[model samples]
Target: MEVFLSICLGLGLSASSGFRVFLPMLIANIAAMSGWISPAESFAWLATWPAFFALLTATIAEIGGYYVPFIDNLLDTIATPAAIIAGTLLSTSFIQIDNPVLQWGLGLILGGGTAGMVQVGTGLLRLLSSKTTAGLGNPVVSTAENVASFGLSGLAIFLPIIAMVLVVLLILWLFRKIANLRKTK
Candidate 1:
């Protein structure tokens, strides 16, 4: 059950990564440093000050990038793989599986897949927003994504089960949004 909760937290964070890749990692870093959670042995560096600062910097940059006009679109192209990689790392860190191969395999599949799917959904949403509003609506979308990343990270740490439920709901919403976007195109 403990392991299950950790995976739940990881998956929740993974979903948040789709919105902002580094914010989830920064949250995990803080959680580790504060003794709220323990990362796997290999990921112990996450509890250190250097990792915290680095993730903080990256988080700030990522958030700021999304508020930029044309750059936000370019960032989406970069965010897909970055979100997958960050999601895999975040999930693998909390998971305590003994087997190296199995741990990473599950992280890559479940965590990466969750983040990648949501990243694509968000990218599509941004594209639709840009098309409909001529890029004026992107900042609003960016703000919402920022709020989601922060909210989900908080829930993932403090309420793993609730976080998982939100992740599910968010994914379902993303699917509906994607379908609607497709209809318009």
Candidate 2:
């Protein structure tokens, strides 16, 4: 049960990374420091003050970058892969499987995959918004993503089961919407 919860938390936080790469890391650092969550032995560095401040700075820069018009799209090109790496790291941090091979396998497959899917969805959404609104609507989308990253990170730490449910629902909704868009095209 404890292991299950850890995976759920990891995946949930990983998915949140899709929206904003550093937000989940910041959340995890705070959680680890506050005793809300415990990282694996290999990831203990994340709980340090330096890591906390570094992630805080990165989080601010990432959020601000998304608010820039054309820069947001350009950043997406970079952020997608970064999010996957961050997601995998986030998952491995909380998960405690004994086998290193199995742990990293699950982290890359589940955590990285979830973050990639969500990042793709958001990138597409941002593209659509940019097209429809001449990039004027991107800040709103950026704001929403920021809120989502923060909310999902908190939920992932404190209520992982609920966060996983939300992630599933979000994926389903994205699939349905994509299918509908395809049908129209």
Candidate 3:
């Protein structure tokens, strides 16, 4: 049950990574630091006070940076790697694994892959918003992203399966909207 829960949690965190890369990691860092969740021995580094502080600082900076008009788009360019790394870390940290290979493989496929997919989708959304809305509607998009990231992170930490379902639904909805737009064009 613990293993299943942890995997679900990892998947949830990975999905949250699609929205904002660091938000879920920051949440996990705080949770682990506060002893709400216990990570595996290999991931004990995340529990350190220094790591927590660093992640907190990074999280705040990332949030603040996203509110800047053109700067937000620039940040998205770099956020891809951040999202993937954060996804892998969050997913791999909680799972107990004796073999390094298995842990890494799962982390790459589930964590990194999920984050990358979400990040790509979000980048496209921002691009389309910027093109059609002239960046005027970016704040609304940003706000939604922030909320989704925060809410999904919390859900991932607590109830992962539901988070996964939400991620699936979100992806399908986005895909359908995009297809409809292409057809209209």
Candidate 4:
């Protein structure tokens, strides 16, 4: 049961990484520190005091920067790759599998790949909005991302399975919208 819950948390956190990378990490790190979640032994490093401080700072900085006008879009440009790496690392960090190969494979594929896909999808929306609305739609995008980040972070620590299901739904929805846009063009 513990393992299952942890995996679910990992999936939820990975999904959240798509919206705001550091937000979920900060949440998870705090949870682990408080013993709300029991990460794998290897992830014991996350419970350290310094890790907590770093994530807290990063989370605050990232979210605050996203509230700015043009700066939000610029952050997304660089955040894309960083989100992918964070997603994978966070997923694998909580996983405690005896099989080394399986751990890294799933970390990169499902964790990193899913986060990267979602990040790129959101970035494309921002790009389209910038091109069409002249960047006026950025506030809406930023707000939605903040809601998603908070929602997924909470779900990751509490109802992880539900969060994973939501991630799948979000992916499908994004894909459909992207497809419709392509067809219209």
Q: Which candidate gets the maximum lDDT versus the true structure?
A: 2
What is the C-alpha lDDT profile of model 4 across 1-185, one tens digit per residue? 76666667777888789899898888888888898887667778777889888988998899898878788889999999998998898888776676868887877787788788889888887787788888888888888988888888798788888988888898899899989988999
| Ranking according to TM-score, highest score first | 2, 1, 4, 3
For candidate 1, write residues 1-185 as lDDT tens digits.
98889889888989899999999999999988999989999999989999989998998899999999889999999999999998999888887788989889889987898899889988988998999999999999999999999999889999999998988888889788778867998
Each model's C-alpha lDDT? 0.91, 0.94, 0.83, 0.83
Model 4: colliding residue pairs: none
Candidate 3 wrongly placed segments (more than 4 Å): 174-185
Which lDDT tens digits does candidate 3 get at residues 1-185? Answer: 77777877887888788888778888888888888888788788888888878888888898888888878899899998889888888888876566778887888788888888788788888888889888888888888889999999898877777987887787787778878978999
Cα error, residue 155 of model 4, in Å, equals 0.6
Question: TM-score for each prediction?
Answer: 0.94, 0.97, 0.91, 0.92
Off by over 4 Å in 1: 179-185
Candidate 1 displacement at residue 152 in angstroms: 0.3
Candidates' RMSD to native: 1.4, 0.9, 1.8, 1.6
After the best TM-score superposition of candidate 4, give how far the Cα of residue 53 lies from its true spot, in angstroms.
Answer: 1.2
Q: Let me know the TM-score candidate 4 reaches against the reference structure.
A: 0.92
